[model samples]
Target: MLQASDITYTYNGGLKLVFPNISCPTGQHWLLLGQSGSGKTTLLHLLAGLRTPTTGSVSIGGTDISKLRASRLDKFRGKNIGIVFQEPHFMRALNVEENLALTQSLSGQKVDKKKIHTLLDRLNIAHKLKSDTSALSQGEKQRVAIARALINDPVLILADEPTSALDDKNTREVISLLEEQATAAGATLLVVTHDNRLREQFPNQITL
Candidate 1:
């Protein structure tokens, strides 16, 4: 469902990072492994179309994202990709459900309350629906982010250091949740992290 061919990126004016060609089929799970500064997150951002690569192409479901206009790219990303970042970011003023509702609204899709509830229930955070984001604990907030990412039922799921803050139990729980949802939706899953503990969980790994 996603492909990155001969991708190269540079930052800080001179530093360059090159990645091997990577492709992910629907219902497949991939782990991007690298240390800090090794460009794992950069690769995830490139695949998500959040940042364009300096060279090469990224395509999702057969369309070349690099050639898309900025407006069209944004719309395409909203419809096709879901990303969970290392840090959970939310509108502090909004409750958890409101935050998700706003995301669906912006995506030009109606909110699917049943799906939202099911996602939260699966992540064990259904009770936080009425709570303000500020009141959630770190783990609860992360689960909320996962719920938001899955709310769109995106075709591709990209997670950057999603297990960074969790203990072993929570890490396993979150990983399992991501894999389960992605498989159910027939979505391609790519998780970027330095955590080798995840290796046993995801056998299809790309080491940078």
Candidate 2:
């Protein structure tokens, strides 16, 4: 459901990063492996429609997002491309459910409290629904982040360094949750990270 081809980016200093082509089918999980400074983040941003590649195209369901105008791109991304950042960013004043409600609202989607609650329940963070984000444990907060990402039922899920700080067990758990949720939503999942241990977890991978 996701395809990125001949991707390249160039900075003002003339530094250029070229990425390997990636094609992930519907409901599949893929690990994008690379070391530090390997442009993994850059490629992730491109795939998420957050950054326009200097060359090539990124498509989901045959829609070449590189050609989308800014407004259209933002709208399309919010509706179809869900991103999980390495660190959780929350509105301190808002409770867990409130935060997720805001995500749906920002996406131009109706606030579906039932959907938000169901997602948190699945991620085991439903107990924190009314708790301030600051009051939650780091792990709980991370799970909330996952819940927010899946709330939109995006067509493609792009997770950047989702497991960089976790231990082996948590890493495995988080990866499984991502895959399970993606499958449930009928979305393609692509995790971009520098972690080598993931090489053993995903059957399909492309290294930068």
Candidate 3:
């Protein structure tokens, strides 16, 4: 569902970061493994169209996203891609449900309360719907972020260091939640992290 051809990026005044070619098929789950400063997160951002590449192309579901106009890219990304960041950034004043509702509105998609409730339930955060985001624990907040990512029913899911702050159990739970939901929705999942503990869980790996 996603392909990156001859991708290259440079920073720190012409220092090249790893930008080898990469590709993944539909329904595949990929783990991008690399240590600090290895360009794992950079590659993830490029694939998600959050960062434009200096050269080469990133195509998602057959469209060359790197070539899209800024306005068109925003709309296409909202509908085709979902991202879970290392830190779950939510509106401090909004409740869980409200935060998710706002996400739907921002994406220009109709709100589906049932789908929202079902995703929260799947992530074991259904009871926290009425709770303010500021009152939740880190793990709880992560679950909420996952729910928000799934709310749009995106075709490609990209997660960056999602398990960084979680304990072993929570890490497993978070990975399981992402894997299960992505597979059920027929969305491609790409998780970028330095966590080797996850290797046993996902056999496929793309090391940078």
The RMSD of every model to the true structure, in order and in angstroms, is 1.2, 0.9, 1.2
Pick by TM-score: which candidate is best? 2
- Candidate 1 runs further than 4 Å off: none
**How many residue pairs clash in model 2?**
0
Candidate 2: 10-residue stretch with minimal lDDT: 133-142
| lDDT digits (tens) for residues 1-208 of candidate 3 | 7999988887759977757777888988989899988988889989989889888999999999999988889888888898999999899888999999888878888887787888898888999999999999999999899888888989999999999888999999999999998998899999999998899988778889
TM-score of each: 0.95, 0.97, 0.96
What's model 1's TM-score? Answer: 0.95
Clash pairs of candidate 2? none
TM-score of 2: 0.97
Q: Mind giving the per-residue lDDT tens digits that candidate 1 earns over 32-65? A: 9999989888898899888999999999999899
Model 1: how far residue 43 lies from native, Å: 1.0
**Which 10-residue window of candidate 3 scores lowest in summed lDDT?**
15-24
